[model samples]
Target chain A: MPEPMGFFTDTTVCIGCKACEVACKEWNQLPAENGGIRELSGDSYDNTRRLDGIHWRHVRFIEQFKGPYDGRWLMMSDVCKHCVQAGCLEVCPTGAIIRTEFDTVVIQSDVCNGCRACIAACPFGVIDINPVSGTAQKCTLCYDRLKVGLEPACSKACPTDSIQFGSIVELRTRAQKRVDQLKSQGVKAELYGADPNGALGGLNSFYLLVDQPEVYGLPRNPQLPTRNLAKSSSFSLASAAVLGVLALVGLRKRRMDDMGGPGAGGSN
Target chain B: MSDTFFSGAPHWAWLIILYFFVGGIAGGACFLAAVVDWFGGPEDRPVVRTGYSVAAWGAILSGALLTIDLGRPLRFWHMLFQSANVPALMFKGWSPISFGAWAILVFGLFAVLSALGGMAEEGRLHNPALRAVGGAVRGGLAKVVGGVAGLLGVFIAGYTGILLSVTNRPIWADSPWLGALFVASGASTGAAALILLAPGRGATEQSLARLSAFDTKALVVELLVLVLFVASLGSVNRVWIGFWGLVLLVGVVGLGIVAPLRLHLQRRPLASAAKLVLLGGFLLRVATILASEGIERYRVAAGM
Candidate 1:
């Protein structure tokens, strides 16, 4: 309702410094994800692998060698999409999850029963339960900072302009212009989750990617799990109704059989 | 496209699986009792009484399992709180889990009342005051309560699957028939429980033979729904193929269904079939949960 503030991440200019990661952890006062010891994952220089209860923002380093001379490193900063039709918010058994004024999803930790419904409901696998707190955790888009007119820590700490934060309309315009500029220079730039009509009703935080969405571990077409509930509930309700009717009918047949039997002074 | 991203499986563990199995059995047992009350006369009172007690006890056990699954066990009351629409108490209440909470509570209460009515019918209650209460329940209220509990029982059985279907995970959302399948299995297992408690050789054989006739039909329907559920996933490029799959195919479909049919046709003993169906009922929940393993975060494996 308040202009729908969000982030538009352009991976082309990302430096993959992970300064945003450190800044997020520091600002949020999050504890170590794996007991504080840093390990260089054999995957790449990206040690902090994926977003979990602790890591809300992750910098991914993708290395490719099309042919020794035709190689490039694809760097992307991944964060919660803050989807318009958030599955987590929809499936939350305790109304602990809420969609904020800025259209970002936030979990009220105190109210959460830690049923883990939201964790499974998340399409992007964004939410997780912080072991210590025993409540689901995910990117709130810096709800505390946004309340006081401050940008998210990750976007503020980004070295390059890869992560841009502002009103949804303004960011969409800027991202489209950047995509056009790159295409003119023979770069295959496409905006993912920018179209409001797209699956999941688009994202408050979207991306500009150089390759297929799968290359970045994003769903080609993310869907709201709630959309499937209609079919499931309907089929089930029908089955229950049909079974209940047949069961009742069976009861009637038994009554008639009893009445018509030899004990009732009738033929068996 | 070749990039890999690992996603952790859902947070549910053994307790939730236990809840599903226990709740399914309870729901099924109550449904059978409701059927007998609606149609059968005094002759079926013994089996009907067992159904009532089993449903009541099953509801209590499953309720305990649900409570144990919660992280803040003391904060369980938080589920019943409706912060946004308190004024609409009749229409609007808690979330889905909250609705389930009240549903189970009501079902359990009715089941207990139904059992009391049975006690009165059999002249089992001793104290005059307790006998009076049982008398009132047996007169008419017990039928209404059993009928209401039956509806709630069916709801509880299917809603478990609906609860899982609401998750974005593919293994859950893949099939719209999970609830239908679960209910059918619930009914079959409930019948098996009754069979296991059959009185003696002569009466037991007749009762089991009739139940087997009904249960085998339920099993056939359950099998058909299982196929429909798996077929629904065909377009998604996912298949149930693993240790759990074998358990479902062999343990549930084979032993639970085929063995029961064989014994029922031969008029032979069905104690083994009863055990197999009960075990299969629980294993079915296990198979359903395992189907979701590595469903997400394995984006890299499928080339996303």
Candidate 2:
């Protein structure tokens, strides 16, 4: 009924303060820093142990450029893409997961039977089952907040406005402009998940990246599970048919043998 | 596992495991139905009737498992109710899975009717309507129902493997033969399960042996494909090599092929040996696929 809502993540401006993470926790009433105090993961300042059920919004800090000429820290807050052709949406059995009128993916916790289907179907590894609730939970893109006339908590709390929230069309335009602006500034920035025709039908929440998507733990080509369902089923059916024929032929031969070479039953 | 190697294993891997698990159960039920019908036991009529019913149930269960894995489970009906994009590898459509679902429903209904007919034949019910329904099911209709269910189950089982094989993941995509291998594995596993569950006899043992033989063949083929796939990678990362090699040996060679062979050769009872082999093979396939993902990730990280 309303204009479809989405996220436009401009990674170039991300300062990696992780305020988005805290904001998400506060708004969603999620636990802050799983496994007690946050310890350094030894990779970088990232100690949140990757995206899980509780931590919907993860601010990844990737340090690159070994010595002197290449010293830059890449910072980006990642969340569910809420894909148009969402694999998780396609695989849920209990109707627990739904695409809202906002066009964002959300799991109804009350309806979820802790089946973990959405967890497996998500290509981004974004959705997970909360160990405590036994139900799949992820970034609702602040569905509750959006219901009221307010922006998502993460976007509001973000000092740098790296995680921008808006309509899908506007976000794509903004993402492209941001990439162009970064390129003008001599930074080779690119937009990810903005191509509506791309794999997974592009994302409602897209990204701006300085490096390859794989570096940021993103699938280069995400696919749906139902794609090969037919071919696989055909193969299975063919095998069964062959088996059936063989069984039938074998049965007929045995029956003939039992009937005395098919002549004993004839009373000519 | 090394951080680099284990990094970003996709969620599809787990869903694939779930697919194989559910499909295996369905395929097994179908094979049981065939075995029961082929050999006339005191419970043969009931077994045959229930076998189709169980296969139908399995198909429905598998479908449910698949749906649960989706991000939007509510839109699952779109695959059935809407038009599908054909060329897209993940295009939701009237696929074998969907067909299998339909087949399961149809076959299940007929099988239930046939079972009711068997009960009627045994004088368990005096109602003429029930007898007339049973008589209809017993004459010509029963075979059609069994045929359709068996066909659908076969597809459901084989497709699980082909789905992975179609992926560009080197471990799976390279092997065109993997699909056939999966079908054989499904059939063998299904037959073995059915044989075990049915009353024990020498004939059942022989049937199980036949199923085991097919499994052995599939294992050999899978092993060969694994070797070729691994060798083609050509001096991959150490972690990738070790992990995949271990998987091939233990999962493919040990559990899928050798365990069943050992059980058969040792002259253990059909039910006992079939159960062990069936369970072992199912686990082996799932473990192999998961390990394959791990290996692929390792190689990717190593830039090989």
The lDDT leader among the candidates is 1
Candidate 1 local lDDT, A76-118, one digit each (tens): 8888889998878876766788899998889888878777877
DockQ of all candidates, in order? 0.46, 0.11
Model 1 Cα shift for residue A234 (angstroms): 1.9
Error of 1 at B241 (Å): 2.8
Off by over 4 Å in 1: A38-40, A249-253, A260-268, B1-8, B83-98, B120-135, B198-205, B235-239, B296-304
Interface RMSD of each: 3.8, 7.7
Local accuracy of candidate 2 as per-residue lDDT tens digits, A110-208:
656554545545666677767677677899988988888799999999998888889999888888888888899998898888999998888999999
For model 1, the docking class works out as acceptable
Residue lDDT tens for model 1, B160-257:
88777766666577678888888888888888887776453122344455566567667777787878887776644333576767877898778777
lDDT score at residue B214, model 1, on the 0-100 scale: 65
Off by over 4 Å in 2: A33-39, A68-70, A252-268, B1-26, B35-149, B155-182, B194-240, B243-247, B258-276, B289-304
lDDT of 1 at B203: 28
Question: What TM-score results for chain B when candidate 2 is compared with the true chain B?
Answer: 0.69
